[model samples]
Structures are given as structure tokens and as C-alpha cells.
Target: MLSLQQLSKQYKNSELALDNVSFDVPSGQVIGLIGPSGAGKSTLIRCINRLIEPTHGAIYLDDVELTQLSTSKLRKQRRRIGMIFQEYALVERLSVMENVLSGTLGYVSFWQSFFRKFPEPLLQKAFGYLERVGLLEHANKRADQLSGGQKQRVGIARALAQEPSLLLIDEPTASLDPKTSRQIMRLIKEICKERNLPAIINIHDVVLAQTYVDRIIGLKAGKIVFDGSPSALNASVLTTIYGKEEWNTTPACEEEVSIAPVPNFQTKLELAI
Candidate 1:
């Protein structure tokens, strides 16, 4: 459903975030993008969404040239794509229902959304989505009151509210514990299967990706080095993608450990330029 051809993103001062990266996310398939830090997994996904403009090449969503679209046209096109962020990206002061309803803002009238006035059917759909994510009881609670896992559930519900044909997830389980991460991964996989949605997710956790996605695409310095099923992603591919022998080692607790000098999500905005 999505095709990226010879994509490249070069920032100022000659920094190359993506170097002619190309790949495809076929209809009804769940694909995983995995690599170590600074390998450009996130960059490629952003480029596909036009969240960051590609320095070169074309991005086609169902054969529609997304890179050539005007801002207004891009907004309309994005209504068919749903994104779930690592941070959950919920509005802290808003109620869970309000945040889920925000997903439909892409479809709702400006005046109705501005006034937080959702139609009854839309509200009912939002309620059903919340229930699906096991968050029905917390529908009226403020986003800030929910736990990390709960907030991510709300994020999933928000994305589902869009009823998208394509899903883009950026480290969807990054902040949750292992057990919670597994639960979230299973939820995402199930959602894609049940809804027949094609998805591409950037994940640092190799085990989770292998366990959940139908295929794995490994990136290294913004280039695709591996594209195949999980069983085909051997040590050599991991070494090429991560540029580290450690990443090729057995699945260890280190992948779960948080990074020091934590990365700045705001830096991604810099990456766009």
C-alpha cells in the first residue's frame, strides 16, 4: 500500500539522515523497522508520512505521490494514515474520551471540533474503541491520571478512532515494562489482523519486532540492509544494521535498559531540516 523509492534526506552541514532508502509496506501486512541508535529507522518512517520532507525521491501511498502534495492536500491524505507515538502524545488535561475524539478531528467540522462537540455516532465509536483497548472505565479520567501503559492504550484508541487504512507506530512500547510491552505488541498485531490495516513501526526492540511483525526491515545509517521474514534476520543482518557486535548477541536485558544522556525527541524536528 506504501512505496518509498530512492528516498534520501540530507540535513544542513552535510549530515545524511537517510541515504536513498527504499522499501514497501504491502496491503494488510505488518512490517517492522529495526536498528540501533542513529541508524535512521525513525527518519525513514517520518519521510514516508511527509512529517519530514525527503531531500530526494518519491513516496507513493497507494500510487499517490505524497511527496508532491501541497500542505492542505497532505492533511487530507493523512486522514487515511494513523500514527501512534512512543510517548503516547496524549493531551494531559483532557479526558481520555476527549483525546480519542481528537482523532476524528480530521473528519469533523472546524466549529464542532473547536467546541468539543462530537456527534452521537462518533462518540459511540470512540466509546467502543476505548472498550476495545480495555480503557472503558477510564473514559472520563484525565490523561495525566493514567499510567504509562494506560496512556499508550489511549494512544492506540485514538489511532483506531481514525479508522485508518495505514498505521505508523514509532516505538509504541518504548515506555512500558516488558510485560506491558508484550501486551501492547499483541494488541497492535491483533488490531492490524482484525482491521486488515497495513502498518510500519520503528522499533528498537528486536525481540518484540520479530515476535509481532510479519516482516523485518533493518536500517543502517538510513539505508535498508535487510528485508525479509523474522527467521531470515540472522546475526549477519543484525551486525550490518546495528554496526555493533553487541546488538548481534542473544536477546538480552540490555535492550530493555534505558539509554543514558537520553535522546531529545525535539531533535527529530531538527532532523527534518
Candidate 2:
């Protein structure tokens, strides 16, 4: 579990990126963080990971106050937080298996990792993660040879290799085509539930997020504007978060549309809703 209390971030120029934002993430829950551009969604994640220090307030992971930790302690705590990047941050020359194993670097000795001599059990675990992401067949391929979706799958597998307590995903579908984006979203949701792992995904596609995540946190100009189940994200809440637009206020009988592709343009119809 993670908690943010009165968290805020102000740049040297005194422009507030996150203003007194507070929230909690419970175990086995996936939260979709949605907002307009420059709404501080990315900033909040960076602050949580201590990549960008919070200008004020405290961050708690379990009972530990992350904001108060020493550098060495912070480094160790970071290993418990998994990160999946929008850019598919991978070593181009490394094989898919090696890339996933890199996630365990913090747990392994320097010489062991440098020599790629991961323990046999760890190697087997990496293989399991690869298979989970449907990349077992490509384990020997270089990262650069992967397509966009394959690369992101590798990214997901790498993050899971950390066996992290919480997942922090930044625009996991930002670069993929529409279908692939949906696949990645569904994959992340399933994995989080299966492992009882809590996750916070900073996402752009509102419909996509609403479809896959358990909850939605809407940000507006660096503040928490809406925090509730995806079903609560009616026209009014979305308008407040993203500014005025002709939103679909139709109270359809369906709660969440199934994510599978269908004939007669059903997938497109569901997305349009």
C-alpha cells in the first residue's frame, strides 16, 4: 500500500506542478491517473519514485515514510517499486531474457550481474515472466529487433521480474496502435489482480483507462479533482478534469464493455462510447 499526504511540487520558478495532492492506493487495486497535458500526472509519479524530490509533504510506502529516507535507504526502497516506461526503456543489444533479468540488479551482487551470472532460480523466474508476457518464444531476440508491442511486452516482463510491491506505469500504451494499446492495458490489469499487486497507471486515453482500471483519479492543474470508481466518471466529472467538451452522458445499461474485439465494428462502437 502507498499513501501521499499533502504532496506538492514547485519548480525553481515557483510554478506548482503538484499542489497538495493526497491519495492512497490499496493492495490489488489498479488506479488510472488521468488528466490533460501538463496536469502534473507525470510529476506525481516521479515524486513518488523520488526521481524528483517532493518540495513538500510526505510519501509512505507501507509504514515507511519515503520522503524522509536517506539516500542509501531510498536506493534500497526503490527496488520495491516497479516502473514501466512509455518509451520501453530497454538496452537495444540485450536479449529479451537479459533485459527482464536486469530488473533484479538491486538484489544481485555487482559481479554476478556484470557477468550475467544470475542464479538459476532467478533465471527460471525470468523465463516465467517472459512467458506471462507472451514473449517466451522471443527470449533470445535482441530488444531492438522487437516491434513496438513486443518491446512494451518486454518492458512489462522486466517490471514483473522485480516482483515489486507496487507498479508505477507511465503511459504504457502511449506509442502502440489502438488494438495493441488495449491488449497491453488488459494484460496489466490481469497481472495486477492475479498477483494482488497494487498499481498506478498514468494514462491519457480516458475510455481505455475506464475500461481496464478499477478506479480513476483525475487531476487538474496539479490538484486532485476526482477520485472514484470508473463508473462515477460521468460527463460532469470528466468536464471538470479536462475542461468543457461535449461528453457522452448517456446512462447506458452496461457498466464496462468487454475488451474483446468483435465483428460488425463492435470494438469501435464500444470505444466510441
Candidate 3:
């Protein structure tokens, strides 16, 4: 449903954040992007939504070239793309319902939204999204009153309130505990499945990505290093993506450990055959 072709980004300081990164996202598929720090995962997500302008290449959503759109046109196109940030990015003083309703800002008139006079159907949809994310009871509470996980849930509901065709999730679990991270990941995957909405999740944790995503793409130094099913991401591929030392020395019990088996003595002997 989405296609990125030869996308490249060069910052003002001559730093290339992304380099000719091209990929396609099929409808209803969950694709995970895993890479080390500064690997352009976040940049790629931002580029998809045009939050950061790309230096070159085209992005197409169902044949509409997002990169070529004018400001007004882009605003209309943006309504179909939802973004979830590393930080929850909620309006602290606003109620949970209000924060979720903000997703419809692009669809409403400035004066209407300014007065908090959204249509009843839109309000009902916002409430439905809140309930879907398990935050219906907290609708009237201020965003600042929620826990980290709950805040992220509010973020999810707000994004879904846009009724987006595709979701761009940037480090969705970066700030949460392990258990909460898993819960959030599961929730995103479940919601995407139920709604058949495609998503590209930029995740720092490779294990979590493997556990949740249908496919995985590995980026290194702003370039595509690997792209395949999660099970195909073995140690060798990981080493190629993140360097051998980082992959090898990772503790066995660490959640980010490579899924491939370590070359122990017995395993080495078996390989000799």
C-alpha cells in the first residue's frame, strides 16, 4: 500500500541520514525496522510522513506521490498517515479524549477545532478508539495524570482516531519497561490486524521486533542491510548489520541477543561434518 523509492536525506551539516533506502509495505502487514543508534530508523519514519523533507526520491501511497504535494495538499494527505512518537507527545493539560480528538484537527475547520466543537460522530469515533486502546475510563482525565504505558496507549488511540491507512511508529516501546513494551507491541499488532492497516514500526529492540513483526528490515549507517522474514534474521545477518563484536558479546540473557545460536564447542564439532 506504500512505496518508498530511492529515498535520501542530507542534513544541513552534510550528514546523510538516509541513503537510497527503498522498500514497499503491503497492506495489513507489520514491518519492523531494527538498527543501532543513528542508523536512520527514525529518519526513515519521519521522511515517510514528510516531517523531515527528503533530499531525493519519491514516496507513493496508492499511486499518490506524497513528496510532490503542495502544503495544502500534503495536509490532506497527512490525514491518512498516523504517527506515534518515542515520547507519547500528548497535550499534558488536555483530557485524554481531547488529546485523541486532536487527531481530527486536519479534518475540521480551525474555528470548529478551536472551540472544541467536533461533530458527534467524530467524538464517538474518538471514544471508540480510546476504548480500543483500553483507555475509555480515563477519557476525562488529564494526559499528565497517566502512567508511561497509559500515556503511550493514549498516543496510540489518538493516532488511530485519524483513521489512518498506514501507521508510522517510531520507537513505540523505547521508554517503557519490558512487560509494558510487550503489551504495547501486542496491542499495536492486534489493532493493525483487526483494522487491516499496514504499519512500519521503528524499533530499537530486535527481539521485540522479531516477536511482533511479520517482516524485518535492518538498517546500518543509513542504508538497507537486510530485509526478510523475522526468522531469516540469524546471527550472520545481524553481525553484518550491527558489526560482529556488538552481536557476539551481547549477553545470552539480554532480550536483544541475536536469535541465531552461538557457535559453542559442541555446535562447532557438529558443523565439522
lDDT of 2 at 203: 93
Worst 10 residues of 3 by lDDT: 264-273
lDDT of 2 by residue, 98-185 (tens): 9999999988999999999999998999999999999999999999999999999999999888879999999999889989998999
Score residue 173 of candidate 1 by CA lDDT: 88
Task: Summarize candidate 3's per-residue lDDT along 1-273 as a digit string, tens digits.
Answer: 999999999989867889999999999999999887888988899998899999999999988999999999999999999999889999999999999999999989999999999999999999999999998999999999999999999999989989899999998998998789889999999999999999999987776777789999999989999999887877788778877643434334553533323232111111100
lDDT of each: 0.83, 0.88, 0.87
User: Which segments of candidate 3 are over 4 A away from where they belong?
Assistant: 246-273
The local lDDT score (0 to 100) that residue 144 gets in candidate 2 is: 98
**lDDT for each residue of candidate 1 in 1-273, tens digit (9 for 90 to 100):** 888889999978977889888888888799998877787878777887789888999988886899999998998888888999999999999999999999999889999998988899999999999999999999999999999999999999999999787999999988888889879998999999998889998887776777789999888777788898876765566667765454333334544553322122101010111
After best superposition, candidate 1 residue 184: deviation in angstroms?
A: 0.3
CA shift of 11, model 1, Å: 1.0
Q: How many backbone clashes does every candidate have? A: 0, 0, 0
Model 2 has an lDDT value of: 0.88
Q: Give the TM-score (vs. native) of candidate 1.
A: 0.89
- Per-residue error for 68 in candidate 3, Å, reads 0.5
